[model samples]
Target: MGNYEQFHLIVKWKEQALMIESLLFLFLNIILSDKKQPVSSTPKTYIYDT
Candidate 1:
């Protein structure tokens, strides 16, 4: 029973770590996309317009 409790605690800790990591990843992606979207898309639009 003690071992099982330890295992469960480890699993829960790992899950929380993974959740935080993924949330950070998603946040970074959103920030990067916002920064890149205008810079990347404007050139294409200008080229097409010209």
Candidate 2:
């Protein structure tokens, strides 16, 4: 019973860690995509100006 309890605790910890990592990954992706979008649009504006 004690070993089973320990196993459950470890599993819970691992799940929490995975959740945090995925959230961080998603956050970074959103930030990077936003940064890229503006930079990408800048070229079109420059071409129109020229």
Residues 1-50 of candidate 1: C-alpha lDDT, one tens digit per residue: 99999999999998888778767766765787788753343322222111
TM-score of model 1 vs. true structure: 0.67
Off by over 4 Å in 2: 37-50
TM-score of each model, in listed order: 0.67, 0.68
Determine the C-alpha RMSD for candidate 1 after optimal superposition of all C-alphas: 12.5
For model 2, how does the per-residue alpha-carbon lDDT over 1-50 read when each residue is reduced to its tens digit?
A: 99999999999998888778767766765787788754343322222211
**Model 1 collision count:** 0
| Runs off by more than 4 Å, candidate 1 | 37-50
In order, candidate lDDTs are: 0.66, 0.66
